[model samples]
Target: MEKSLLKQRLLELKYNNFQDLDVDELLPLMNAMLKYIGDTDPDLRDTLIYSSFSSLILEGRYSNENLRKLLVTSVSNDYLFYGIGRRQDDSVFKRSFSTLIIALILHVNIQKNFLSLVDMEEVADRLINYLEKEVDVRGLVDEKGWAHSIAHVADAMDELVNQKLLLESYRKKVMQTIINKMCYDDDYYLFEENERMVVPVISILRQGTNQFLLIEGIRQIAEDLREKYSSDEKSCLIYRYNFKQFLQSLYFHLEAIDLCEDIRREVKKALKVINQPYYAIT
Candidate 1:
């Protein structure tokens, strides 16, 4: 297949709306590229076509004005739905989220309910797996990819939850595309540690600690201490400092009282001892 032929066709489809395109005219183009797209060298082919597809989607690829064109786009997915007899592989070489997004768009736009939860699960799992294991220690993605994995999971999960394929409660709570909170305290750090990744992970978890949990959790630690410390006159806003600081203050207050008592006792002894001897002369 000449590369320019597919490129030229995609270029035309890019500007044209997919909602209205007649599928009959679009089949030969897709049929011609089937082998290449479904290749073992997946990334090589996926990355090249996805760059154009991504640009088109962002540019109103399925807008109402292009409804006819969208029908043409559906033909490719229609082939996928009919089970194009091909070797299935779990490994993804190219733009991971791109295919999923296309499939999701096809599902929603083309109204294909036959596609089950597993299809989306595969995409979501790939996204999390890639971020957890594949992204660099720097949390950077390849320039060829988009940072839409997490966001895509949230989007697709939203659909599944609405469809009842996913439990409404099981899907991760998202706050503007980040994992927001979990109701259960049994799990923490749903993501693996990498500093760049931690910011989103931590910010999202903060919601898990409600006011009741904060007070109760602190109460448990406070009950184990030996001495209770309080000062009304000296300071108002002292922190609960180290135990050593509390112990030193306790001793200082005791020692000051002991010294005052001793001075009083000595004064009484001197007064009693000198009184009788001085009285006769006076």
Candidate 2:
């Protein structure tokens, strides 16, 4: 497939629209198109991604297994993180979101086989780097609608954690990143997305050998919440929900650990205080 021909066919297929088509007719063409896409051009790479997943989304898990296997194998962590397609004016965060979305789809659908094909540490390391670079931490959405980039990273991390694909040493770092993000913003949308990562982050702690990381992170969060509540005018917003969920999850995990009694006492005391009203007339 020449570059010009490949681009033309992609534009043609994409423009022709996603309608009900005979699988026999569409499968071969899509497979061939995916082969030519090989991760060089960002625009075409994104198109290839959309092409790969559109069927599953629109027609219920429709995908060419052999072709998708080839496609997933070709996806590189560098491409996902740094991205080859970002324009001069475009946001890298926004661009990386699409690539990660494609990676998430492949990961969910392919499982360990996909993990076997890629460098799990490299992928996790790059994503953590992106999280650090992220200052705005806004969701892909604007007033127009859903962008889902920031949300996608959280979801991808959740997937990685659930699969036990992230290495143990790096797990604590990932957990810290998420714990920091727990109270990073007040936007309900972003906060809600951040909250989705909490369960997986907690899961890592439960499975990890290090109790200090979990205990310390939870204590800090508890203190953060106590400080937030001290301010009468601080609109804690989604932090209210985040705080409750964090305590519940932390307590659940703390019960399974034998050495964190002091931390537990402090957490339980904070929970009691938070449960009480700001002003009790009784």
Query: What C-alpha lDDT do the candidate models reach, one value each?
Result: 0.34, 0.54
TM-score of each: 0.34, 0.55
Instruction: Say which candidate scores most in lDDT.
Output: 2
lDDT tens digits by residue: candidate 1, 195-225: 2222322222232322232223223323322
lDDT per residue for candidate 2 within 1-282, as digits (tens), equals 566776676676556664534566565555554444334355665554355445443344444454345334333443343443333223443334443544545465444344442456655666676655544444433332333445666766665555554567777777788767655444444345544565566557556547677567666666666667655544474676666666665566666655357657766776765655554512
Lowest summed lDDT across 10 adjacent residues in model 2 is found at 81-90
Quote the lDDT for 114 in model 1. Answer: 37
Model 1 local distance difference test score = 0.34
RMSD to the hidden true structure, all candidates: 22.8, 7.9
Question: What is candidate 1's CA lDDT for residue 221?
Answer: 24
List candidate 2 stretches off by more than 4 Å. 1-93, 102-118, 140-143, 163-165, 185-191, 205-212, 224-268, 273-282
